[model samples]
Target chain A: MATLSLRDVRKSFAATQVLHGIELEVADGELVVIVGASGCGKSTLLRIVAGLETATSGQVVINNRDVTELEPADRDIAMVFQNYALYPHMSVFGNMAYGLKIRGMDKAEIERRVKAAAEILGIGPLLERKPKQLSGGQRQRVAMGRAIVREPALFLFDEPLSNLDAKLRVQMRAEIRRLQRRLGVTSLFVTHDQVEAMTLGDRLVVMNAGRAAQVAPPMEIFERPADTYVAGFIGSPAMNFIPAVLEDGGASAKLEDGSSIRFADGPRPGPAGRRLTLGLRPEHVEPTNGDGSIPLTVELIEPLGSETVVHGRAAGGMPIVTRLQGAFSGQSLSVHLSPKHLHVFDAETGRRLDS
Target chain B: MSSTALPAAVPMQAERDDALLRATRRRRVMSKIVAHGALILGVLIVAFPIWMTLVGSTHDAATIGRGDVPLLPGSHAIENYATAWNEGGGKSRTTPAALMLWNSLLMALLIAVGKITISILSAYAVVFFRFPLRMAAFWAIFITLMLPVEVRIIPTFQVIVDLSLGNTWAGLIIPLIASATATLLFRQFFLTIPDEFVEAAKIDGAGPLRFLKDVVLPLSLTNIAAMFVILFIYGWNQYLWPLLIINDRSMETIVVGLSKMIGSGDSQNEWNTIMATAVLALLPPVLVVALMQRWFVRGLTETEK
Candidate 1:
């Protein structure tokens, strides 16, 4: 059984702390994705797990073995680098077999493993060719094949699909998810792409400024981000945040322009007249044909074939985007935000206040 | 009426264009001739000494001693070559030209391979590993770039004597093996390798030596071949070092042997044999460079990239 755990993993470079007390655990066969913006220490955390980088303070345990002080080779882990670091001179089979050969595995066993990985990656025909001869997508597959041939205890992927074009990235991520499930190897993947994190991760670690802001399943992070950072970061076109003050015994928050939205699920853990931020995703804001909705001054409309995204300024001068079906064209339009879709965070600390 | 006017303007414009084209063609032809002339002149200027030596080697020793070196080859070609190959030409010496060539070849190959091996390892260590005083160690090696063998001849000779490597092939090859230029070049080439390769190798369970053999060395093939060419020529052309170290006649390299054949000024030197030995001395380096020229150019350009 393969499981990975990090206990208070911290990393510092010179005087700057790149990762601060990162605690995570991956169950057997689980794929945990650490997603963040660049320089948020997601890659550093993955590297620490891979044993390529050492944590300043903490323990990295793999399969109940403490591997914090071990070299990467002794950790029994495989990694797919962001650049798909295939040996340029070696053929695909050779690149896949190199790790096995280094461990002095039998020649037949090495060949068997390499062939199996090549077949799994659908690169059997291309195994005789050098990495330079392969296309970018093929090279990416070979990198995965190389990692797969090792059959290590854990798989660490450091933004492996970021180098591919967007269309290919989607296809590759699906393949990666399928492979991980089939192999039942615990893995930790890091990327700056939220879509990748959402679709591929069994659980997502939403990282912000060297700390995990929220750790939950994809829909949970989307529906209820732990803080304003995760609320603004996870969704496309981002979640709209507006200054608001909690009122009516924390059941409702009044926008700066006097419009009010109540928590649909339940009351938040805050007193009345408390200042907080209200967040609503672009997709959740529905356009209505009545005076009951807040007025949005239409500034621009982005037509994305099926749905149009309307960019406008809300009544409180806060710019917001709303996704609408078909097309809507007007200088001013009214959109309604449901109380169930509202997210409230402390104004001073940006921490979520509502359950 | 507009068509008629257009025809008149078109012919005049065509005539002007034709004149301009003709002028450009004429200038191009003239420039080509000038370029050819300049190139031929440069070739002749560069090739004159080699040509003179080639012609001089074919003449008889007596004829060369008479101070009548010919521009054209003489009838004594085979005789001079055979004499030079079988017997040393100086009055006091009798070592064969073949033995000198053999010594030179062994020394050059040893020095070349030795320098490359040392350089590649040192460069790998310097670039890939992070130890204490890494930059300091690198700078120490780099500073040796300015100090050639000529500058440190006395101390090197003394060290050779102390080590008791005097008059041995080891003395000849070892003193000139460590090359700061090769190390620096290899280090620079190694630096261009992406860090991902090392990281990937580590994750692949390849140790330092395995990584060097499986990844680093294979990637450095072109660089190694190119360095081999350069170091071979550099080793083959070593004159002063061999002369200082090799006291035994049998260990004397062709370059040193050739210099010995030409006695001090005013003596009746074996000019023909000396010229023949010179030709032999130049052959291997030229052949080495010619054979590896493709890899040399590609390696240099790829190393930079």
Candidate 2:
């Protein structure tokens, strides 16, 4: 395994630009997860690294050698697709052994690698079964096994668990992580699921509209989103946005009822009365006892085992979410912010004002 | 009593309920009668010509002229077969019916195999790889499906003649080797195959050829079966091109050779022998269709998505 680097990589399909000057590096045996909403160019960046797509005007250097024009086969990278594109005609064994056989590995060695990979996937009994006979989860495993047998320099996963059921997705997600850790190859994974990025990625690269918003570890991403887009795209129940204005001694958001809620932080960069946006995560919201707080009227309640998510509208017509610990039995509710948990962004530019 | 409560058994209730039930029954029975009538009409429309062909294939020239052949199989079937088989060729001026059948079948196999193999390779390249002029080449191949062979026949024929492949199987195989229908079908189907699977194979270090053969082609057995049936049927029934090129009677396909039997001879046109030869010639393609019938429909519909 060796380091891979992209220097000002850009890609465009005809006139439509998909990736814009992406600069990233993957050290030996590092696993980087690229996360974003749909059309964010995360998948395109991974495809660029795998040599499935060519950079429009940049260099893709692997181990200090420029391989910008190399085909996927020559790149020595393995990729697992979301749909698990297994050969429908081949049995599990054939599918797993295909890559090795192509690279001119001995037949006995091919069998050994296939059997070993199949065992790792716990699909030993599935060796003789064709792809159609296998379930979605099994086919995904076969796809992984096909990649595993080659032991390529890098492993690329393009949302490989999206087709699976919830339970199976979690299971396979863990299996993939474990397998990658065991193999320790330089890897790049693309996903739209922030949760997957948090749990599976060694470091997360949050992208939006063909640009990287932030590249940080999972906790750091949640703790310090580099911009408004990263803050909104990298969390669950997405952070609530309420229009606000900077005022004397604090940030002030005027409520629909003509009242105001004030949050104190370090000195503002922009001047007072400048319009800004306030962001609050659901988990930081607490049921308050007064009308002076961010007044909210409950609209919907979703109970998911450990917590109940209360959907409501904050004052000034902004949508709000408050997560109630365990199952809370109440319809009429109010929320108060913890003050320090608020995120402030420039209303026009949508840039985060705090680190 | 409430609005929904029924009255006790009385003359009024009994007769009124029975009449209401009778009306519903009559409507159901009328619908059944109409459905059966429509079914019979459809069956008769389709089965009439087939029944006529079967009866005519059995009767000799005398019964056919008299138009008095029964629904039962005739005893003259053996003699009719012998005549079609021999073609009364004391001098080899024309090939017999069996030779024509062989020629047609061989052409179908070459066409089917060649078209399918090329379709898989070209479709794989276009769908999964990034190369120069990738999509332009795809659309170029795809455009040929819309432009009928009639538009290109003259140039095609000239090319065949120039290549000295006239009246040969190579003539039949060369021009139509890249079937747009198969290529388009496989391309659409391959597109539906998850990109992840291709990624998986690539990570496995499988090259393009290995990917096509081991990863793609196997998943395509249904497509192959379907393509075989459709292309084989097309090649088997093709008449105009072979008829135009093959002046030698021995080189004609079953369709062309069968048509020749009708107008060329003074043997009173041997209606029975001609019909018998037609039926025999139609059997292999029919059998092939029968064998792959289920896959034909599924493959067409499945790949379309």
Candidate 3:
């Protein structure tokens, strides 16, 4: 396993700068996922690390060696592409053995490695079949097997499960995580799916507009995102933002409708009377009929078996969504906002405020 | 009570269904008859000339000379074939049909293979790699499609003579090998290969040449077979180029020999032998097409990548 580091990696295509000074480090045996919307430079960063694209200005160090100028093959890295990219004419065995063969490995060793990888992927029976004959999930497994056979210092995955159906994606996500843990190879996974990033990564680099908005563990990012962009991006159904003003000497946030939420954690890092943005996650809002609850005029209800998501507007016509554990149907509901889960950002800058 | 009521209503619906089925079956049979009739008529119309040639090959020359070409075969088939195979018709340029067939086979095989090799490599370089003036080079090659061999016959003939390649297989084949149509077809096919395959191969430690051998060539098998069939026919039927290049009677192609076998005024030509030689000329190309027809149709329609 190797430790991978990117130092001030910047990329440009003609006049457009796709990656603007990205810095990251993956400890040996760690999985770091780069996640963003399409065209947000996440894939560009992964390609730069894979040596498919040269950084405009930077250094890529892997296992204490600077590999910025090396070809992808010489860099000891293997990549699993989104489409699987299998040679259609070759059997599964051939696809996995191609790299080892090119490296001049003997037939016995190549066969051994391919057989072992196929077994691990539960695709031993499929090794004799062509890629076109396999189901989507099987092809995904073969793609993983091909990468695993290389036994490279690092593994690069570019949305490897994006083409599969939803249930299969979840299954493969766990399989990939388990496989990476067992192999203990440093890996960099890039995807546009936040849930995949959250579930699979040891740590995530949440990218926005060609820059890393936040880099932290998934739960840490979910609980305390560094900025408004990360706050809205990392969680499903997204975090809600409401215009507010800091009152009571930064101890509480007074929203535009005159309702206020007190910070139970402590005094936040903002001046009194300063305009701020208040953030709350959908799952953190509890439906309550008690005092100190915000009234929500319910507009829509989505029943998702175990959880019910309610969409509505609060006072001052600010849209809000609340995900509750049980089902509820009504014209209005009072929801209690936990002060511990409240996020505050400066109105102009959108940077998170710490208590 | 509901079951009894349902059984009574079912008989009426069954009557209607039976009527509809009979009408549909009648229409289907009528269409099938019309289709078979048209196909049989088409086969007869197309096969008439071949039938005439086959029948004439079995008759004596005197029968054909009197302009009473027989509708039935005579007992002269064996004699006519033997004469044509051993000593071709009307004697001015009697390269035996056997030697002519061998010469035609060699030329067609060489030309087809040579053109495919040149075209695939040129197309690969054009589509896969970026170089200075790449599009300019592509457009230049594309412009050659306008200049058929017939248009540049005199200059090409001069070049062949200057090189002193007359009557040689090199002279016969090389001038006809570089085809713009084949090159363009290959270039179009190569462009559709996904970029990811190239990147994956590069990561697998395969250089450009290795990738072409291991991946590109196998993927192009169908296309190559299809091109082989077409180019073989084109090369086999070539009349003007072979006529201009080969002065030696020993190297004359079957097409050229067949035409020369028809003698000028007042010379009696062996019509049966000429007809037999014509049959031999048509066999190799028909076999090539029949053998490769499946891949030819597939390659034209679908790209594996």
Return the TM-scores of chain A for each candidate in numbered order.
Answer: 0.97, 0.93, 0.97
Please say which candidate is ahead in TM-score: 1 or 2: 1
Compare candidates 1 and 2 on lDDT and give the better one.
Answer: 1
lDDT scores of the candidates, listed in order: 0.88, 0.80, 0.92
TM-score of 1: 0.95
Candidate 1 pairs with clashing backbones: none
Query: For model 2, which pairs clash?
Result: A78-B203, A81-B196, A85-B197, A256-A316
- The model with the greater lDDT, 1 or 3, is 3
> Which scores greater on lDDT, model 2 or model 3?
3
Q: Candidate 3 — which residues are off by over 4 angstroms?
A: A269-273, B1-30, B294-305
Q: Which predicted model would earn the best lDDT?
A: 3
| Predicted structure with the largest DockQ when compared to the true one | 3
In angstroms, the error of model 1 at B12 is 6.4
- Candidate 2: tens digits of C-alpha lDDT, residues A212-237: 88888899989777778988887788
What C-alpha RMSD separates each model from the true structure? 2.3, 5.1, 3.4
Q: Write candidate 1's Cα lDDT for A1-355 as tens digits.
A: 4999899999999999999898888899999999999999999999899888999999999999999999999998999999998888788888898888888899999999988888888999998998878888999999999989888899999999999998999999999999999998889999999999999999999999899899999999998799999988898988888888988777778877777777887888777788898888888888887656888999999998889999999876889889888987889988888677788889999998855
Proportion of true inter-chain contacts also present in candidate 3: 0.70
The candidates' DockQ values read: 0.60, 0.41, 0.67
lDDT score, residue A170, model 2?
94
